[model samples]
Target chain A: MDKRILVIEDEEIIAEYYKKILQNAGYEVAIFYNGNDALQYYRQFHCPVVVTDLEMPQMSGEEVIGNIKEIDDDQVIVVVTSYYDPATIINIMKKNVYDYIVKPIEPVEFGATIKRAFESAEYRKMKKALEQERILKLERQIEWFNWHESIIQRNYDRVDRELFSNLHESFNQGAGFGSLLTLIRLIASMAKKSNGNYVIDEQMFELIKKNADVAEKILNIFSELVIIMNRTFEFEKVSVMELHSLLRMIIAEIEKYAGIKKMKIALSEQKPPYKSAYVNIESDYIKKAFHEIFMNALKFSKPSTAVMVFVDMKTEGVEILIINTPEIIREGVVGIPVEYENLLFEPFFRIAKVVYEEFETSDYGLGLTLVEKIVRKHGGSISIANILDSSDISRASETKVCVRVWLPLASEASRGERKGA
Target chain B: MDFKKAAESMQLPLDDYLSLVQKFLERLPQYREGIFSAKNSGDMKRLAAEAHKLKGVALNLRFEELAECAKKIEIIAKGEAQIADDVFGMLEHLIMEIKQLMLAKENRDG
Candidate 1:
């Protein structure tokens, strides 16, 4: 196969050298010095293998690498660095870098490394393409299921929307959007996950023309989720004193990406009765949730008004208050909550009236399930109700969602505290 | 284990470990940085730790005489023990031995 490759090395000499070697080996090569410019063509000119040096002047190899690989994990990146150390190893492994070449380069070794990188990249592209093809094939089977179910529903005069929805929704998620809709979604996601490249052999190229590149669209959803997933986490044991400091760290990381709307996070327990109950939570999840909400608040709210985090020891346990300065109405929450959507924790479910354009990605966990299970493990309750605080919810479609997390606290400690009080 | 065999396994030059004083003289800045930085950083007191590592490497590489000198620096840096004159002398002596080894290799290779 005549493979296409992209090289983003700053040195003209090195770039020329690589281009010659790759071209000689029958690969069509493209080179760029700038990171952002290279990134612009990332999807447009999807290459299987990418070679970059550690310190590029403008974006740094690390930044360009973070951007590109997040778009597709399978993109083979061989890092060329002068310094080989344990610290370097830890940082490099985080992005799942394919391999590294330590400098004072050997010409033979360099050539060999690039060959290996191409093989790795090709392997990933082939794997994702095959998985996508399998998913699409499953969808076709589910489409047959959808057809049968739809015909059955047409014959029955009375059918509830939820029940009717369930008939297809169950298999849609299981097989992904019932052949037609979500199979396309998964294919597009898989394409994005594969760095927007596809196996464009004569057969696939023909099929893609009819398919409308649903792979790109489907991949967009997952890409957005990935962007959310990659947000920062200073995963430290945060005491109540460190809440402001934690927020500062969170703000520092995200400030480059999103503007803060008025978020004032304060530890509300002013007295000595403060409890340090630390749960091993992924800070990435917490940051993602807050960033989405803060972005929404910034986009929707009146500027200069303060959005706040008010924490209190509620009956359930520690209640975290994300005080939204309301301008936009929440969407999709009405009547009874749907089971699957509840698990996604997405804004669409929280507010029924929310426009699709306005929705942002949310967190997931078997943790939510397990917490309730463990609460049941130790006999605890879980519930939610919105307090009518002075700063309005009048314009909102649903009440402000203050998620009250009821962790099972130590009863002996509680009783002792109560006696002391 | 034979000190020479241990030195060989560790990939350290024998003569370098033998003349400890000269080696210390040559690596004074590095030794100072690694040792004192470890003291201040509250991380692993790694300079002395690294010296110990070098000692083992030197011993395994059959540079036993120099390894003995490295042990002095290692003990002083790592062990929270005093650096006696004899140990310091061994370090200088090992450094000189290492120079001689390098000089010999150069003469043959050249």
Candidate 2:
């Protein structure tokens, strides 16, 4: 608990009176002659309780209260004024000020009011902490529910039937179903005919190779899904790295993919101060997360346009924004509308069909969902939004999709080292 | 003025009460000049503000008559009441009387 109280009063006599009384009551008191100076001090070092005189020179006490509340809405303020009008008191109370004391104050009553204000501040702090914990618990519950729902909703059966039916059709038009058993019997018959030679004709070998490739691809997807669902990373594997350097590396790795789509990955230049912004992460998992984001950006971007990447430093974290002008913009086309933004990270909720090589596979829509899980496991957050172009005269155009990821900054020591390096 | 009763009402020891009174008297000329200047300049807002300050300190120190006089000036300057021609003169006389009373008490204590 902070025992410091800030007293803002223009009258030196009154200020000194407050200081003396509060100090005698065992509170550390800081006195400012005006609201401006008091607020300036408050921005740097916050005192839980503020006692302000409503009439002051540079900034009125009401302005002071409003500004302080802007900085921290829960800041406890007690207004001290010489005279009070009922309307004035009502207006100040609307600002959520704890209480106001009319001057010519009774000392004991003044002290008691201050005590109650501190108690309220303490209670507010506890309530905020509890609320945050509750939110975190609810988020975890939602994640669990979504994971189980994806599994229980017959996603595996649907994917299996679709893939087997497609493979059966490709093998032969009349190979109705049970494609796996038919293919296995075909392989065994071929092996028996080879009879220790294991030789096959060129056309037969090509057909088997194509089927094997598709099977391997499906196996890989399911393997990744299982790993994401079950694995917990070891904390010891986490390392601190400058975010700009990591982003530059990711961009370098994905530039080839972007180039294949006739798109460019343009990374913003790292400013000097923010070059030292470091984050603690399991580099491989974080790399995979950004790779998924960049790949999605490239896959959806318009030809010859740039997928822009920006890294910005926030108060307690670093934010990465990936912006791309998408290729699809027509009504009812494959685009994330504002209303559907929250569902973008839900498992198996893909909005667009991605064409791989010459065919479109059931994409499972887990790219972003997996990325979200990885980021959240490392105590970061990810969100996507469709940016609308309001500058157009005729209609609002959905111009771009922005994927933002925020990761908590590493310790000061790591940042200092990066700066030195 | 009853010094004992005023000090008791302020919940201050006699010595502490006398010290605060001395401090108030030291600031008396500045307070008087501020009110007089605001009134002469026809800046009723400043006049009301100055009077409000004086009224607050006087009330806190249990200077009942002085507080009442300052309050009237504040109300009149705020345009809530009509200003009397003799009000300023009355305020000056009350201030002088308080100063004399403090001086007499100081001499008697020494």
Candidate 3:
């Protein structure tokens, strides 16, 4: 919305004339008597339209145009000169001058030309903005597609492994189909012996029912697992929430869990501007991702040490860092190595034994993996790295683990909508 | 000087045109001095440059006769033609005439 017009004319009377006319036309005007001064001013404040006289003292209009074009090729320049030679006109045209005004210009026509120049400037600004937006959208789409492909591949691998292991264990342990067959045989034999008299004991009946339930439960769980693995997720249920509010809610919930280990959960205080930074996310899923990461941090943290959470607004998005000091490094219980830090997101990858007895289940090692998957689904990424103490010059031991998560900010359109609401 | 015609060509009100004429008259002495000094020194390039500057301002103010005289001086100097004494004389005459007219308007207005 810059409506300033720069006039570079050596003739004081003519420069004044242009100022009066342009000002009357509702434009803010800055007049320079020489090209050098004008160029200095232009460098500071880029006016939308530049009206420069060709014959000036220090620098000629052609030189001014060349310098301005070098600075910004999209600059709009209009030449004003008394000499109307065809060669000079062609030269100016080759330099990409927008239009030329001869001496003793018609006020109305000059006004019209300047109006067109301003229109061209506006169009160029809009086009540049749209091009940047298009590139960002394409980049996001490419990232989403890449993440989607990896998730699908990982799902297949997990399902295949789980199916083979479950089927093998069922056949070996006789806890599923084998137990059901044994119970069926015992019931048949009891019924045959009864022979119109009730001879089956209540304990025997209860045992048969319990085995049948176990077999059914196993089959049902397998089917459910397959369905979950192949399910297509819909991501339309997103809301724009401030980063501070989301972190506060998660931290409040995890604070209780940290209390049992006599550990403290500390959240870094964010400034007002950064605290209000909004991110578009499914609140429930993002909470789960953060919860898993926080749990991991608390689990590996030395007892009674503080788990520090820092939320920072990065250029591309919001970054949350959870830093926790590990317990004393013992043999086979050291911090994750720097080179293998990325493996933290791989399924079934465990660096050490589970410290918390509550999470001792089949899904024990998949916490960070599931966290990474959920983060990636929301167009985010999670990474873990070991933090070496600055004082430790040898760099032999890592003191802490830092779990970093980056999530994209809410889109401008969504922010506008939120503002309206 | 045809004040109405000049004002109309410049697309300005008579009062605004008169004030612009005053500014031009103020700078006329400097332009005249630059031209004669360059001619005396036989610096054709400087003479042509000074004349060109005067011609551009004269044309903008619709001083057709003055502009024509300045343009002739610029061409003759740039072409390395013989320094005709009458060309300088004619330019002086035009500048004096415009200066007198602008001064008269100022007196009448005051």
Could you say which candidate leads in TM-score? 3
Q: Please, what are the lDDT tens digits per residue for candidate 1 over residues A140-214?
A: 878756864676557444334434443334334322224446444545555433466553346434554433343
Best by lDDT: 2
Off by over 4 Å in 2: A136-421
* TM-score versus the correct structure, for each prediction: 0.29, 0.47, 0.47
Native contact recovery (fnat) for each candidate is 0.00, 0.40, 0.68
Ranked candidates, highest lDDT first: 2, 3, 1
Worst 10 residues of 2 chain B by lDDT: B7-16
Q: RMSDs, each prediction?
A: 23.7, 22.7, 22.9
The candidate with the higher DockQ, 1 or 2, is 2
How many clashes would you count in candidate 3? 0
For candidate 1, report its TM-score.
0.29
Instruction: Report the lDDT of model 1 for residue A384.
Output: 30
A133 Cα displacement, candidate 3 (Å): 1.8
Across A1-421, the per-residue lDDT of candidate 2 in tens digits comes to 4678999998887787778678878899999998778889999878879999898888999999999999989998999887578998989989999999998888888989998887666545434543454465477877756765766464657545544554444334222123445566776677544455765556756665666665565567658767756776543222223556777898898777776777877666566767455566666878888888888887777878767777667788877878777877455654465444666676556555444441133244557777888888767899886654332222344356778799877666664233210
Ranking of all candidate structures by their DockQ, best first: 3, 2, 1
Whole-model alpha-carbon lDDT for candidate 1: 0.50
